[model samples]
Target: MSNVTTKKEVNVFIDYLARCEGETALRLNVDADGEVRHYEVKLFEPPRFFEGFLVGRKWYDAYEVCSRICGICSVPHVISGVEATEKAFDIKPGKQTVMLRKLANLSELNMNCIVRIYILGGPDFLGVNSVMDIAANPATLDVVKMALKLKRLGNDLTDFCTGRETHPVGIDVGRMLKLPDKHKIEPLLERLKEAKEDAWKVAEFVASLKVPAYKRRVPLLAIHREDGYALNYGKIKSTSGFEVTPYKHDEYISHKHVKQSNALFYSIGEGQSFMVGPIARVVLSFDQLSPDAQKMARKYWGGPEWFHENMPFSVYAAHAVEYMHTTDEMISILEKLKAGMDESEIMKEKAIPQKGQGFICTEAPRGLLYYTFKFDENGDVQFADIVTPTAHHVHNLEQDLKHLGPSLVGMSEKDATMQVELVARCYDLCCSCSVHCVTIKK
Candidate 1:
């Protein structure tokens, strides 16, 4: 078969595999000129009907219900959901509450990033079929074991803060059910210290790989923070210097509906594309990284290219650096929480439901996750809006493929196919999060 026809065949195979992840479809047509004739990412996960479903529910109900959006991204959904509700009610959670929330976000990041690197994305980069294949191989078995340990730390952190890791309970508006006990926090911090070392090993392994020398000029976007890395905190920062409060998401950022997909894709008012998630966070929030992580980034990437351009290779390094930073940051946080451990349950507040709107954006494992809610005087949800990182990411990934097409055209079929898959997997694309924005057809 000619190389052009083979590359097109691989694109078809990717679309088939995408169904296993979510109801997503991709169509790429390359013209005789070896340029992209057409490209589209269509997501058709069943309509969730979430916004209409929450219409008459109390604000506190959002944390649990919105969490159902995606099993992997539930923690951020819950945290950002509560933040939006708290903003509408004008309530600020106590110190301990905020600390616990931060810990939960870190845990989610660890779990998701590890699975993507060692399992899903691993095979693509290694030219193997799956993590199972890697695990069964004598040469690579030890690598999989190390990855499991890192993923376990994320689950441990989640379990410590919220009695349940997935679809966590006890995080109502203005309330945190109970902080992890001293007993739990003490042991977890110790294990995390060890996990830090293992993370370094994982980082070294990923850094040793040959990263694709791909670059595209899409605008990068992420939440901005001054105190530290943005997680359930900060204002929106885009590569273009466009900054806006979360409330203005609807005003400054806009979404477009394509008949081919169920998800709503976003842009910065002018219909321009932008990338989000780890690459955006790592580049935009570089200064805020801990000293250790900054040193590591310098060691691996060795220059400022990642911060200035959209190089997919930077995504792996960015994820590795953040993985290390989160381990240390969580250790520090656990020590403090352990010292002040108390047996008290979440305090109840008789907050009167105020009539207003609330908006918030937080860094989730995947990238910039956002939420907005409007409430009636009775505190019932009048309307709700959510934009997951995957939705915002679709355009950047497709654009990248367009730029990457020419180089892929004449390569050996297998090499060409793998390169295309590697590029798609680089975003760590989470179709579940993207197609989750679906609604019932009117």
Candidate 2:
């Protein structure tokens, strides 16, 4: 054998991943000896400019506009945007307001995770092409029904709290424009209580599936709190043993430009990239998970080492655990709301824009969602920046492919391609939110 050089470009189809979130292409270069040399995770979507156009808009318009970033994650974008605005103006929401915001965040996390774990990731575990195919098979039809029912309940909970299901309109900075109806709380809570069994069924279903094994130890970053599982509130903590407030994220996590991607790549200083999302959150905050969720995690995920090891495929398993945890949290919050609604929670105050800067990093269902904003004295937005979770994961996914691609040297192209897709789906990439800016050189 003299020499062999092969190049292949693969476009990830919608059927391979969950609900056609967006498009990403993979380019792999394999050398003559069957060793992989280079890989590029190409993002084709045009630059969205969510951050670019935000300048010159009013401060209050930030969340409403940024919320359009992802239909699946509009709630998280809104919450992050609102929190960033609150920080800029020095507005401190009451405890009830914080609790209700947590409810909103948890509701979306529950909904997004159910979709990813059951409706989306389920087909992969079951070795099927699409969820429709899962429904067509008599053996898995019940699984489909259960997934849909659970998804519906999640949507209802999100809608009840946020106003509309997607791109919700009831929440704003410092106050709730619309509070959840008192009469509806009892019924919603009852439905949530009833869904606990269904939640377990989904988790058990995931636990039964075989997870592809490929391990790597990349820095895992998440928002952490000492008192409880942190979603909206907490300092940024990483598996590397570094803690930084959200304001200093720029000093630690830095963004880079790559010709292969329209989105930017982020690293925690030097050339090392880090992973964020469900896996990071679960690993960093395992101690803070609800007791029931912890029991399920240990039972299904094979104790803590499986997570501590930082296995990429374990992301699916992590999503299942988070689903269980968020359900328990939602029930607890709903019970409190059912007992009585505080007048302060529903009250709204007008925000006076001051010339100041604010920064926030919150957990979206997929992972860390970050936002920073500056306002003029007249309450107009002087500048805005957002770093979505999908953008954060893309580079790490490429790094994972580098580690996994060499293993595919002897396999058939089709089999090798699928293994690649499996890893990508594991990140639950939301491409829509990732492609925010593209570089243009004059």
Candidate 3:
């Protein structure tokens, strides 16, 4: 064994609140070898901390407060939180409400995929510095155009359902503020059909890459529903064959501390590490995908080797499959609405608030997001806990880095750093989701 004590510190900076204002700071840190020897990940008090300040407030207040968790995913957070609160009070929205929520969630997923591919994954795939480079490339301009179309389609769908794309104003306690008539939603369905075709092309292209050879057998956790692959609600199932409802969520998951950062490290059942998100969900719910999606998965990822590897390309493939599935489902739902699903006629019931706990598990763009809220008799939030998928995978990212680092001992620092960053990006770690701040020190 080498006694060099090769220490590495990795720091990921997050400045959501600062950027929301005018001033921004990049938290930094140093990674010794591949280990986070010293680190800080900056978090602000405005949004997440503001949530903690919402104790003793009415249940509806959490919708606006937690919505600020990340500007990108605010809609899902708000809707999911609201839904959970409603469930706690034993209140259920009518048919139109359910349909609208589904539309919004699917729209958000579509937009998120576009952003991930164009802004993040594009540069990494093309070995370029940014999407602008890809856009300028004549050969890849079609891909760029497709990405833009998909993003616009998502925005249109959001507008059709919620009346605005970002920070929508339609959501409320009993029902949404807006209703979708045929004229409003038809154009969106048409656009989604086109977008779904384009997404398949993207998946085919990604599947053509020579995937890297790395496979670690870790427990996969996801939400499984009896009807189909659930995006909005389901029971949490593990690769080890253990399944539990969201109400028993705390029994299966827990978080801890690491030396280098304040962000909580996660483990399951006496150091049994696991992973969640796109890959896990796809693997566990493969049979639940739409027919088109199933065909595409087999077409692209049919080989036995594909099933054995933990390649990042699998994530892209799964994302594309998920996009297709959600789009198809949205179109079907829209067709139902056109066939006489009315928004105004459904009955609404008033719910009495008692001391209760609400639990929810939904698939965010990143993966499974679990939210738990404890409400007092007045329907005021007494306590809250959110378990994000990214948190569950951070330790695995570090482990991959550590394994890859020893092989790069003789290589130049630049080359080694690139390798590590690639691995980190593969996990799609949103340092913003973490509670700690990041800082790099020499």
- Which candidate leads the pack in TM-score? 2
Q: Residue 262 CA error for candidate 2 (Å)? A: 6.9
List model 1 lDDT by residue over 82-176, tens digit each. 98888999988777788788888888887877877787676766767888888999998999998988888798788878777888875667768
Best by lDDT: 2
TM-score of each: 0.91, 0.93, 0.84
What range of 10 consecutive residues in model 1 has the weakest lDDT sum?
10-19
Candidate 1 TM-score versus the reference = 0.91
lDDT of each: 0.75, 0.79, 0.66
TM-score of model 3 (CA atoms): 0.84
Which runs in model 2 stand beyond 4 Å of their true positions?
A: 1-20, 259-263, 436-442
Please provide, for model 3 over 1-442, each residue's C-alpha lDDT reduced to its tens digit, 9 standing for 90 to 100. 3234543444444344111211122233345454433223322332345436767888877766766665666667778787777777777787678778888887887787667656666576577877788889999888888888888888777777777787766776667766765676677667777877887886776666443454456677788887887777788887777888877766777767766644466667875666777777777788888888777778878722354256544666666777777777778878877777664733344346777877778877777776777799888889877666666766665555445544544444554455555555556665455432222222
Range of the 10 consecutive residues with the lowest summed lDDT in candidate 2: 7-16
Per residue, candidate 2 scores C-alpha lDDT tens digits across 1-442 of 2112553433223232434477666666565454666776765656778788889999888889988888888888999999999999999887777888888888888887778876667677678878899899998898888888888888888889888889988888888877789899988888888777677787788778786777887889999999988996789998888898877888888887776554477888686888888889899999999887788888887755677584787877787888888889999999998888878656666777788888888999878888999998887888898888887887788888887866666555666677777787887878778754332323
Residue pairs in clash, model 2: none
Poorest stretch of ten by lDDT in candidate 3:
17-26
Off by over 4 Å in 3: 1-47, 209-215, 303-308, 345-355, 435-442
